[model samples]
Target: MGKSQKQRAIRRHNPMRVPDTHLPKGLASASSSSSKNEAVLPIIQKMESPEVGERKWACVAVSNIIQNDPSTRRLLQGKNVVGALIARLTDSEEEVVVEAMGSLRNLCIDGGYDICAEMYNKNILTPLKAFVPKISTTLEQYLANPKAAPENAAKLVYEFADNVITTLWCLSETSNKALNAINALQLVPFLMSFLACRDRLPLAPVTAAAQCLYVLSDDNEPAIDEVRSNGEFITSLLAIARTVSDARTSHGKVDIRRLQLGVLASGVLKNISPLPLAVASDIDIDKELVTMLLPVLQNTSLRDATARVPVLLSEQANEVAVDKPSLKNTPKSDHRSPVEIELESIENQLRTTQLALEILTAACATLPDPDVSKHDEEADEQEDEGMEEEEIDEGVNDEMSVEGVPSKDEVKSSVDLLPSLVPVLIQLAEPTALSFPPLANPSIHPPTTSALGAVHIAALECLNNIFLSLARNPSSTVQADTVAAKGIWDGLWKSLGLVGTEFGLGQERRKQFWELAIGVLWGVSMVWKGFLAPDAQEVELLKLFCNSSEDERVRVKCIGTLECLAQCPTAVDGNKIIAEYLFTLLPTDTTPPAGVEPAIQAGSALIDIYSDETFPYDVNFRANGYLERLVAHVDAMKKLVKGIDRRKPGGRELRLRGEEVRDNLVAFLKYRKALKL
Candidate 1:
């Protein structure tokens, strides 16, 4: 009796130990060597008990087991472990609830389908939903009286909000059930509210809410539709995207939280509207939202930082003072941190660039495709001519008017962001050095190579979209101004120079570079034809790129650019250079041209030149002898097409293209004859 009484007294004094009388059958047999599954059941049973001390002990035990032993996760799912944890969400004891949330979160980290599905079936989110109002109340209280609020108010609010959001984020990974639950609970607006209160709230919950929204809306149309339907939610998200904190460290660096918030806001925007115009259709976003994003797309801070050149004399002196022999033994320097930060800046900039591009792409989608519109207009005219006068009048009435379409002014306002965007592209397209300290071992902290092919590709696509938008809305005076700006043209020319120089760039990037270059040329010609003439260097680069074997798309684009240049009244010398180049591709009266594709492309370009009534026809005809060379090239194309066998690969298509060129040439000759030229 004395020994047993002494042992019981000792156990009663030990706060960390659960008395054997309190242990369930599962725990009573648990030992140090026992598997966690065998140990979790009894602890889970105590977690559901009414006694506060037992519940607290059980919660702590379960958290440790689940956090430390990965295998216990599936074992805990065997019974009503998740259901019990969910029920504990509103426990009067905050510590118990926190432990439960942590364990639940851990379970979800690798909690396979069966575990999550079981939790979903048990309606785990019901108790979680009850905490939302608590978060809202805390946020409202803080907003009303920030100075008077309890010290733990912000902490409590963030914990509750983050736990819920994280649990949902985890659950959403397994199925759409979590998302469905979120929608049913109307949690989207709450999450939006948290993000809106970001100025006062901690970033952890704000980011958690953002991430939850990102996951919930991604590829989930119903969620996206819901997000879109909420005007306030959309407004709040855009505000977050635009908000920039003024906080900076002693080093003068902006807080990383600001960058993260911007990125998350971008992710949310991408998930919700993805297509900017679709969003614009329902809301007046063209001005406000686009204005917010344009600055990000044009961010040249990374470029500015890397482009900073040290004074030449100082650099030379520093190089001379460095001891080369001791470099190998020198420890790695802290200078690499700035390079790392620069890379981070580049990453953030890329994210912003991508978001801006998505917005632009969406805006572009709302407008008509220029080529498709032209084809449609031609088809309509033919159909109208075939109808009787009364029928034609009726048809005109039935035809949709372009009046409701977004005006060129609106389109221009959006695409005019291109001028700001082009310099960023040129900056990113060129490589920059990431040098370590001279004394540091080069092998240890070797210069960081800036591989921005993805950035380059995105920039190219953004440029293409801008060009496309401009082409579709030729009446946009704003875009015309953007195009005619010296900055825009200078950026384009500099980018063209960077085409083949991006280190570690892949073939796709090269193709993208050419596509962007050619697209800019064509866009300029289409909108402000003959207004800007190519300089001799520009013309020569086009010729070189046009003749390149690097990519067929590049060559084709080069030819198109040359044609555009030739049509400019200010570029008669360019026209002559182009004419001579095309002449060289002609069959020398004996053999066909080496490359059938280039020949066809050259012939097509010449046809475009001859058909350009806007060009100074007398100068082309007299000074350049363009008419004579064009006729000769057309004759050579006819011979080349005839020489190719129709049965070979691409032979038939090549011949067809050649015949089309011949027809265009013949039409131009007839026009020339009619004018007695």
Candidate 2:
């Protein structure tokens, strides 16, 4: 084949789609021409050409068009186009494979089970098998430098995994590819397991992990069975955990050993008995791995690691296995850790333990209440009456309700047998220490460093999640019930007031830590809403939160929190300064940040708050023309919604939230004749 013809074949066979919003023509043409459509037409012509480069361009054009009009997606599934794309996967050209992945992603976006099954049957996944290893290697390199390409690569892999997950599991005839898919499952698992274990990892990984896990962990019996049947693969995971103790004894850094033990714990937790037994034989329930792992927590370095490990492990172990090893069993020379310990010590040694204690408490609290009211043999007459109307379909709640959580006796016995870390959490969130953020210019307070600032923020987040857990289900123990709420509310108030601070002595670190603190507080208010009362104390807290002097990120979260609280029946004022504050963040008659998706999303979510008809507000009250100000921001919202859809095409659209804003705005406008203009 001639060079031109090979290029043509490559383009024709590649399955990737082009994004639709690119101005059709190159910038030079766009600038010269009066009409954007005229400029775009030439680009379309080039894309549709059978020439090699032309076809590659055409694929991009097609993808772009697909974003605007959903109807053309069926064409990609046609034999003429799809067969061409599949052939390009093996074209020995990197760009061709990239384009092929893109095309396949577009076709598979939001496809039904039949569509996914058909795509799988057509051997579309074969290309992905060859493609992902290359992409993963490429992304691993690019992530080091931080570029657009590697992120795009990550997105493509995420889309493919999502499609396979949604469809019913079928082992592809291509054995090598099926194995590769199984191996690929490890990446998603690692990512999800990381997020599940700790929330401190950066946002990119968390977002990517959630999407990937959602796809891979969908309940498909066939996939579950197939993964489990690969003999001893599951057992080997448990057996490998024993190496952690070996590593620790060999004088390895306990942190690394604890992390490995943590991962192993999570792996077992995710795959329970039926799944494990299907893979491994002669597994002793009594000699389960938790006992071996529990000793690792003795080293104070392993506290946080230990905490997360058990949430996953507690789920794996039966009643006997979990209680056999105790925190008391740790060497007596190791003193009992107390809440009065210094804030820095808690940050370094015991924070993870605090989190683990919260998890254990939650697991204990969520367990089914033991069957207390038993059937009586003496109720012979009632038994006959019951037999007369027996309805066979008794379904149980999947989630344990607060009312049905294990009794005080059950929790006390289970937790008492293990290590005691509840005091560590209390110490971290206690009012006596007052771990506040450093001033805006830390040089002004030379004694405190940025590391201190970061530690302060992390402690706040830990306090928040702990508070959320407590509020979700208050401990029945009288002592616990008395102090948990007070300690949490006090810390929350202090953190809110310490809003303007710099962390790590640099602008980026300062901003990052600030954003984190805000997220932590927002998490507290929103996550614990179900268990907490919206009393006067809470209203005052909300007022302090929204009264921001600096840190726009802090203000943004405050807005979200207040929005949530406003919908609460006991909120003090429904239409308070929320609308005005939201309008300030939005782009005015002025242009907004050129292409910052995060900023746009923030604006959209805020707008949605004012517009939601479901939002609890008096019909008579109105923020100074909130709809009119919001209408001026419509262009910004539309741009953001489009950007999100474009960026995460096969992924969740931002419009799910944006649409709510638009609808509410329309409804509010219709009701208030004066505001319509």
Candidate 3:
């Protein structure tokens, strides 16, 4: 036969293509193609056919349809495509199982929670869990004699394992049931084994395994505890994060793979509980993680977001009228160009920053609380030694015995990242500008609110941790130069002022902000004596917020800050401000039930100030009418307590608080009289 004749014969007998001539009349009509669901039903029915080839083709077809058109996913789900595919997971044909798993993964990709919940209800996890032991046994056999194992067989093992982990990861994204079920099956150790696999596995499987672990750990305390207990696993994750971060830094470009690895590792680290005391030395792991995360926190995109004006304003550079109506008439522009928008949307960096902060918070939580009794004993021991070594340099003696600070190594490790973290935190806390020329007409662009409130909260919490670590470790010193260079204290004070003035903030938000600011202040004061005292503006801001803010929570936080400031002898103005506020609250007719807390706080603060022998007794108290107010407050409290019913709900508590204030005032009065002031 001629060559063309032979080709024609081959085409006529092709087994791959089914002749349309065999289709039912309904399916043969073009009208049947209008609805994807109706058109795909025949192929889906083939998925359960007895013929292996038919089933494989059906799986491939369904995967392609779901991949090409997402809308068909819901239709496929309704048609029980998941049940058919999940059944094929145990199919003898490798290609059939691969296609089935692949199709299910695609369905779950953009499938909302309902799809996942549906899949979970269909016993998809039962097969997935069953597949793990097979893969493990295969991987073990391959590892036993890698050279004897066919390369293709090894590759197939990894491929199946990757698909399984990926599908599980998708389900985990929306279903805690899947997460807990997988975790309960001891999959964490299996996945961690993959991470620590000696053979150089492809990034796909490793990344999938890490991500699965991350999702599993979320809100699952048992999973978290499991991961934490596995020190090797934690170490492997940190190593991966460091390697990826360093590689990205060296390349000076963002690799999505590296970003994904770093984010997943940090996320897992964030979920794990703090390291145990026996493994306290592992804090270096945390330090390394922090080092890896610093670059991400300082991502250039966030910096650009902070520094740039709104895109609309930047595009309208030549326009002068800043009114909203005028700006609306201006031609529309995509202020953030596509590339900038993509950069902004790359949320891995932000997620990394948040995760880093959480890890640091956990690390700080593990530190031993400061020992007040130990501090006193240490002070007494230091005084005895000081007298014995009278000729010893006083400065040297003071440095050696600074009470409340942690050991030098502990302190150093904790604050190692503070210098890098503090500045980025300050930037995140501040609101971005809306216009380049400062918005001459306010209506065009009112003040833009920062969307990074969570980041700010995390940063503040981390800063509080750093401060506490430093304060408790009196032997550890925060260099004045370091604080000034980073503008750490300055930024904190500015944040306090900004939050205090922000009237648009929700009551709860403002209260939280104030509480964090005050806590940070207290932490700083404990470490750096007179740090709060010398900042008159900060002290005044606290006072202003206390007196003017209608939110009782804000007022309470401000009063707490005032109490902290009053403890510093150098803060004479702070003491006076606190005393005056207390005196005002002391008047029985003016004091509300809510007022008692702050008033009592103020009285305790005054007692602290008076008890300090170094306090300027005559100048701050006697001359400032503080003493006279104390006497009148004591008298007023005594009168007020007489009218309260002891059995009433809050009356006894109020009376008790009032008496405590009077007792504090009476003690202060005695101290002042003994001084002959």
Clashing pairs in 3: 404-472, 405-472, 405-473, 405-474, 406-473
lDDT per residue (tens digit) for residues 357-447 in model 1: 4444444444542122344455445644464323423333333322234575767674566556555655554433322112221112111
Query: What are the runs in model 1 whose C-alpha is more than 4 Å off?
Result: 1-223, 229-235, 244-253, 263-267, 270-283, 297-299, 307-350, 353-366, 369-406, 414-431, 434-457, 475-485, 498-511, 549-552, 582-604, 612-666
Candidate 3 whole-model C-alpha lDDT, 0 to 1? 0.59
Winner on lDDT between 2 and 3 is 3
lDDT of 3 by residue, 1-677 (tens): 00011011111111111012212234234233334655467767888898887787777666555532334555666577778888898898887887788767666654545566688888898888888899888887887788988997787778778878877876665545565676678778888888787236766677778877876776577778887787688778766766655645456777655566766777676566455545445465555566666666676344464444355446555555433221113222225454344434343344445555555565554344323344434443464444332343345434333434346676777666566776776666543332111112222321222123344556677667776676666534464644543366677777655554544323344455665666666666656654555456766776766776665545655665566666666666656766666555554555554465555655666666566656563367667767666776676565655455434544434444555566667877887778775
Better of 2 and 3 by TM-score: 3
Positional deviation of 571 in candidate 3, in angstroms? 5.8
Whole-model Cα lDDT of every candidate shown, in order: 0.57, 0.40, 0.59
lDDT by residue (tens digit), candidate 2, 244-309:
456443555545424433433333333333446555456543224334434433443323422343
Q: How far is 270's C-alpha from truth in model 2 (Å)?
A: 5.8
Arranged by TM-score with the best first, the candidates are 3, 1, 2
Better of 1 and 2 by lDDT: 1
Q: Show the colliding residue pairs in model 1.
A: none
CA error at residue 463 for candidate 1, angstroms: 3.5
Indicate the residue-level lDDT of 270 in model 2: 39
